[model samples]
Target chain A: MENRNGCKLVDLPESTRRKDRFSFTLLVVIIVLIPVLVESKYYLIVLNIIGLNTIVVVGLNLLIGFAGQISLGHAAFFGLGSYFSGILTANYGFPHWPAMVVAMLATGAIAYLIGYPALKLRGHYLVMATLGFGIIINILMGELEQFTGGHDGLIGIPPLSVGGLTFDNDLKNFYLIWAFVFFCMLVARNLLDSRVGRALRAIHGSEVAANSLGVNTSSYKVKVFVLSAMFASVSGSLYAHYITFISPSTYDFYYSIQVVTMVIVGGMGSLWGSLFGAAILSFISEALHVAKQYHIIAYGVFLSLILIFLPEGVLVGIQHFYQSKKLQRLIAVKTPFLLWFNRF
Target chain B: MSNSDSILELVNVSINFGGLQAINRLSFQVESGQIFALIGPNGAGKTTAINMITGIYPPAEGEIYFEGQVLSGKKPYQVTRMGIARTFQNIQVFQNMTVRENVMVGLHTRSRSEFVRCLLHTPMVRKEERMIRRRCNEILEFMGLASKAGLLAAGLPYGDQKKVEIARTLATEPRLLLLDEPAAGLNLQETHEMSHTILMIRETGVTVLLVAHNMDLVMGISDTITVLNYGEKIADGSPAEIQNSDKVVAAYLGREPW
Candidate 1:
């Protein structure tokens, strides 16, 4: 407290601070310039989809990557958001923005009820529990014809608007979705850098040690699970409003697995890895469309290849590669000179 | 000893694992500001007793009290918040986090911010964060780990890792500290340093409850020693008394022919 260095304890080291600032500025510049630079509407739509997926993946990263809680029923939360928003707006005459809020809250509550019991048990219990819940929700989406519109899907979900501006076009929604994505990333970075964030990583590192230090592992797990569900719910609501149409097939078991895969492909504990995972996987899935009937197999092969080569996900994997290469260069430059001196 | 001097009291506490009686109605008291040692051989329920006191496993019988509050049925975190902290036999530092961050986790109970406030980084949250960091730096400095504050906990030497474990628990500002095997794997010099560290920690006025097998380290630092065998308290007294006790020698130290 008396100030040995005169620097605050909360301040990151100078080098890491510089790097973090650089990356953050770069991200903002990309977000601001993309719409101006790209002229294609189709590309904008795809970018919007990437933004949507990035939001879910960021939240999922906090749960799975940082807090070490697995969630397989994120798709259920996603679907709940879509259905709740769709019914409340298209059928029940509620306003679009209010409907999305309700969707997120409802999904969070549902996740809490599930997580309270599931998180109390260790290991794959959460994985199995969420898997079953996701399947059940998917089935309900098909069977609940009255509210959900059944397998045929729901339409006429009014586009989200504020004041006089309506996000009715791909260009407008591109800004709309990316703004949400930017806010999600900002909040996530803030959380991850703070005391709460440290406790979460501690839980992931060793729950017993964390608990002994008063971190409350189970409660934190449940809280993160709920927060992740809320994130998925927000993404789902955004998707419903953006596309103006959705069906049971969109949010299913496969979608949950896909998002989970994105989290892994991004990196288990890396924040930027979440965004990279979403962008790269989304692009690969779209690119594989050229294979037509064999796209699934192509996608599977691509994922397997990435996993094999970059097991820690792309961002961390690349960082590790760069550092090791630098170390090799150092050895290459120093060892021979030391050997020559030894000969003398 | 009077109840006022006792910081921790285990009253006939018992636990079982299926057919095995891990701890059989063992009871003991740790006096305030004293270095108390629980010594026993392998499988003598030393670690089990520590787990029970920390609420990792609640006692199946009797009660454990800390500062006159019952710890039974409480969660481990709850027990920690009640001013009891512990370190593991196998060092349980958060390997991915820095040494400073590991100690910051020990200061978790002192802060009250939740996820929403943390995400937004409210002014109060920032203030608390700064306070937490300052405390972490102070603790690391005390433990002679300030220079390695940025290094990951996993990168530290084995002896340093153990010190980091103690530094982390100290951040909790515990009234009663439970150290499991503080000198189990240390070499002669490291063990000697550890003995001094324990005495130094006791000088800070924290009551220590240590579980150890090293007779020299235990006798050097501990004011009282309780010997256990087969999950029962075989002998309890001051180090000199236990060293001279016939029962302790027969059950633990082994007797010499007269």
Candidate 2:
């Protein structure tokens, strides 16, 4: 059968086509109903957290998944954003909105500066440079006590207000966070579908080929690096405003690893995969309250299980399974028909 | 041809890889709407010359002019924007992407829009996007790949991958197209088809520059043939002159002919 676009799915065996259609429908339904099902204030809080995490994961996805660049220091950008916004709002008396904007810009600028030298390094060297950047930020967060509020972390931050309305409660914050998350997802999707996204993917597949294709590979790399940094900064701004507090400990290397895990566990190079990954992992971390004592151990076990059984990640595995089932169904339906038709 | 008719002119181009000279003062002109062949034995710097012409490597000496515009210092993408597109000796399709998506990438240079237009799905952007897709489909159909548009490039057979690469280069709407070893892995029948395709591409007013080792295929379709050996040009003339050149035979055989 052909889809409305005149793209033929009949060429794909019946079982395979059926599964594809079913899974696509299922995905759409889930996306449409997620907000409606999240009714509880507590669950809404969880969703807001998911939204914040999704932003960082999407950024990390562009860097690691699309650009084929590994960054273990993204938390540096996150922490920098938080500190930048916290300082501006707390000391400069800037509004939270402008502070957030300034914070994102600051993070992007810093990323662009560091990317010039950091992007020159490849593979393990790149990892080292990023790790060094993270360590430096973490150290600065503590040492710059006069500006950053020291180890006690900045507190008593104001809520985000717009047009005489303040998002002071969990419900309001949930909508705000989710709106930002949706906007971010839209941006990420657009970037993935645009020329820049294609160039990034081409570089990921093979940088040499990408260069030959007339892509300025080095410049594109730096651009994605800065763009992803800005994305992480936005998430950081949301976190600071929502909690009304900030700490260096929160935006550590461990947090960066968590974000990377979310992207990888979702399915590298798949935007929807990153969302699924963020939701599943974040849910697991939150749901197992008793396992909080061994949260690290629990996280390790969960990640290990995902890596072993679903090496391509949960979303990719699900997609593969759906496709195979669809193919089986298509063959089952069409084999006899083909034989009868052949007799004619 | 006059200077205006010649889309790409490489004047005394030479590229040195460290101590080794890959292309030694090589010069040629690709007039618009002609198929020009560059043939050489293994390690004769055929790909190296194509690389320089396509902006992957800067010539150690010489100037490249495309449509009266100097292209020596320009980047590869800048060259592409100037309407020169090329394929690799090894098949270089974006393996993870579908064939249609791969072709769509070639259309990227031609697209005119900011990031905001794509994000908002503005009517104009959508219209332009649809037009590009339609054109991509047309190119695929011309290359006999309409049915496999949705297939991941890596899944396609070698011959089809080669065709997809050519189709992608065509999507750029280039004035000059360069093919590096297009018939490298093809069977005799496929090579015949490739020759026909090359002719078809030439008929479309796109200059063709083919680098190949297959003499029979090269002799069959090339309007002008240039032979290279040890980074130096050995022969430059019509296909019949190339076939009869003693220097060409000596270069291919590694010895002077009787």
Candidate 3:
């Protein structure tokens, strides 16, 4: 029972760790190099949109997957960020980068204020509160025409700049957006691997047990809420700058549901799953756009199929398949090795 | 009792649920380095008393002190940080987490590194993490769970899950540990093993307060026993004294001498 460091080392199966590292590195390499290889501006725009959605999904995953909290109004925060940036830059003549920062901080503050009370409600009650918040924000965007430019939305938003270079081209903006997404992913990865992440998992498991272990569950819940909100805000800012036009309809409750569906279909509580979810769902929406009347139906069918076939989500399903194969290989190798040793 | 020596003291504690009085003005003291047992029948308020002690409920009429600090108003997590840890009667292990992860989570209070350090993977945080890992392993080994440390908590057998829960509680490094029905689902062999584990915990000089219905186990290990009937203390004495007391038998049998 007594060890030098005071804990036992339960060795993880080496193949699993190797596969994790390999997949993570492979994802980083592909994301980093994709912009260089793609020549089509349209394709780059799609990639940039995927990056933006990835940021939002990552945040949503923290709330729904790790903390086990339901949020049906997250699109309200996204809409707020967009409108905040759009209003500040369009009317006040503020620079785009500075406006992004201000929007993020404002969204984070709003989330903090709302989360304090919202976290007290659990399950369906929490979902209703979040939905109410979304509806209120959407209605305000519509009613406050002068500030949000009414239903038409603010147009001609100034392009983002870094050190005097404007990110006006799809290629430049693609690089910029993906860089930000990568940073967001890194922050999320670090948070999920830290003490805060562990606490969130414990709360997700059983709040009573978490409390008995001395975890401040309420505070952690609020903190995660704020963090997730900030991620959404950053994504919103990217969308505002990239599209250069945003209507109230873009940030509706339907959009929030789409993001949630992505996370669920990709795999809950997994970082890679968030990214995969965004990519798959975004592709589905684009692929069906030509069949205008059947687009929504096709999207619904895809979501249902994924839910039924892989309830843990696509990423987990794939990971499980790889794991079982690796285990089989290990067993195959071990049997022969054991037989050889028996001869001694 | 003197303030310096007592680890936990309940002063006339009582709990009420509408018309029912679950615990009626109960008073008890647990000193450092002692094993105290609370025994009673099914409806005798044993769990209620434990709930109050662990901050799940505030006493309807009195104060609870831990390490000479008033504990009546604190939250459950606050009480745990103040050096008290407890296990539920029904198993409440973090079912989705790995066995080691569950124990590591319990070690949350012991690590002093800030969130920033953990996120950055700073040298200090890494060093502290290694220390925590070591300590958690020691606790697992103590509970004879070193072999199954990598398995998810829900995948373990019933007795092992109970052991993991105890190990998780032990990782909190509480001065006062309260176990509610630790032997409830355990077989005879497991019950014996648990008795040994309790003795080992006592050997570490931590005060343990157990609520149990197993009369034989209680009588064998407790330095002092408190018997409850209808939320009132019927008797409080050494094992031999409690065994000979007429009130204890009468309370257990639900009758009095003719």
lDDT of 1 by residue, B1-258 (tens): 228879999999889999999999899999999999999878899999999999999889989888888888999999999999999999899998988889888999999999999999899898998899778888977787777888888998999999999999999999999999999889999999999999989999999999999999999989999998889999999999988988877876566767
The sequence of per-residue lDDT tens digits that candidate 3 reaches over residues A1-344 is 36554554565433444766686678789877887798787788888888889999999999889989878888988888888899999889998778889999999899888888878765556677778888899988988998898887888788788887988888888878888887777777766666667789999999988988899888888888887888899899888888889888988888889999988988999888999999988987888889899887888888889889989899998879777878789889999999999999
Q: Which regions of candidate 3 deviate over 4 angstroms?
A: A1-8, A12-21, A322-344, B1-3, B112-124, B256-258
TM-score (all chains, Cα) for each model: 0.95, 0.89, 0.92
Writing each residue's lDDT as its tens digit, candidate 2 over A27-80 gives: 556546766877777887788788889989988899888998988888988888
Q: How well is each residue in A1-344 modelled by candidate 1, as lDDT tens digits?
A: 54475554343433565776788889889988998999998889889989999999999999999998888888898889888998999999999898999999999999999999988988868998999999999999999998888999998889999999999999899889988988898888888878789999999999999999998898999998999899889999999999989899998887888888899898988888999999998988888789998988877887798889998998899889878978789889999999998998
Candidate 1 CAPRI grade? medium
TM-score of 2: 0.89
- Clash pairs for candidate 2: A1-A10, A14-A330, A15-A326, A15-A327, A15-A329, A15-A330, A16-A326, A16-A327, A214-B77
TM-score of chain A of each: 0.91, 0.85, 0.89
Candidate 1: give the clashing pairs.
Answer: none
Global local distance difference test of model 2: 0.83
List where candidate 2 sits over 4 angstroms from the true fold: A1-44, A120-126, A287-294, A325-344, B1-5, B256-258
Q: What ranking of all candidate models by DockQ puts the best one first?
A: 1, 3, 2
Give the per-residue Cα lDDT of candidate 1 at A317. Answer: 90
